[model samples]
Target: MELFAVEIRTPQWQPMILWYTSALNMKAAVRSVEDGYALLAGRGWRLSLLELQEDEPRDRSAISLALEVENLSAVRERIESLLMEPSAPIETSDEGFLQWTTTDPDGNRIKLFQFVAVD
Candidate 1:
């Protein structure tokens, strides 16, 4: 089965939308402020954010999303330019994957990785 989208609930919708758009360099494929929902599409993946009520607890630590990119350096530069710090230093895994982790405004862990062929 093909995965179409992943949905997240956040107390802050507008800022979350802006964060995803800027971080991923993607635009919302579907957005409805009145309905409290936004769907962001990038690199064939869909990220949907739904508005959460004030009473709802927001704990994003349990949700970690990993994205594979072609240019790890470029993505790192973009993240640095945004003035946000990564959760840890970037390192190459034993499996030859260059990876790092960062959190969004709501504290959702985002893992960025790229496959590096070792000569």
Candidate 2:
């Protein structure tokens, strides 16, 4: 089955929403402050953030959300504008992908990758 959306439960709901929208350039499609939820949509993916009462985060390291992007430079610029530093792009030519990674405000890993032809 095709994936519909990725959901993140976080205590830092508002900051997470802001970070995803501003840093990753995801569009805020639905926001319900009263309901403590937000939905962000990108090229062909949707990200949802739900408010949680827990102060400590779970082991989210087991899973990371990877995004396929067109312009790595433009995405990098947008990430930098949010004052959040992303890892340097690592080219895996053998694997036909160029990738970089960053974490959300709640420390969820976000990987951005672009396909590249092996020379």
Candidate 3:
């Protein structure tokens, strides 16, 4: 599985991003999240806010964009090799939720989600 280099950048004025994993319908994608969040919530998408505070962040924001990786293990290794400041424990999840973090640079919160092979 090749890692994707996709990155998202927010406008200069608007500085914040709220991410929620959408309940994907595709077959291959849902393999990890078996029986998808059934008991607690139905099959739409559950969203939880990250470290979002109103108390005047820096002149800049926390994160600029995210990086989707091939797997959790690889992503973890790649992040470590980069020698960047880790924000918090990579929100670990077995359902391929996401391994997220914020870098020291601009205190930008970046996310790397494990993705399945397509095609």
**Maximum-TM-score candidate:** 1
- CA lDDT of each candidate? 0.77, 0.75, 0.41
Segments of candidate 3 deviating more than 4 angstroms: 1-53, 56-63, 84-87, 93-96, 104-106, 115-119
Candidate 3 on 1-119: residue-level lDDT in tens? 33232232323212222112233321222111232211111244222123323453443543344456657676677667676554356575655455665564555545566644343
Number of clashing residue pairs in every model? 0, 0, 5
TM-score of each candidate structure, all chains considered together: 0.47, 0.46, 0.39
User: Candidate 1: where are CA atoms >4 Å away?
Assistant: 57-119
lDDT of 1 by residue, 1-119 (tens): 13445667788889899999998887899998988988799997888788988897766565656677888778877887665553467898876889877777777766688889876
Q: Any residue pairs clashing in model 3, and if so which?
A: 62-107, 62-108, 62-109, 63-108, 63-109
Point out the worst 10-residue segment of candidate 2 by lDDT: 55-64
RMSD value for candidate 2: 12.0
Better by TM-score, candidate 3 or 2: 2
RMSD to the native, candidate 3? 10.6
Candidate 3 structure, TM-score to reference? 0.39
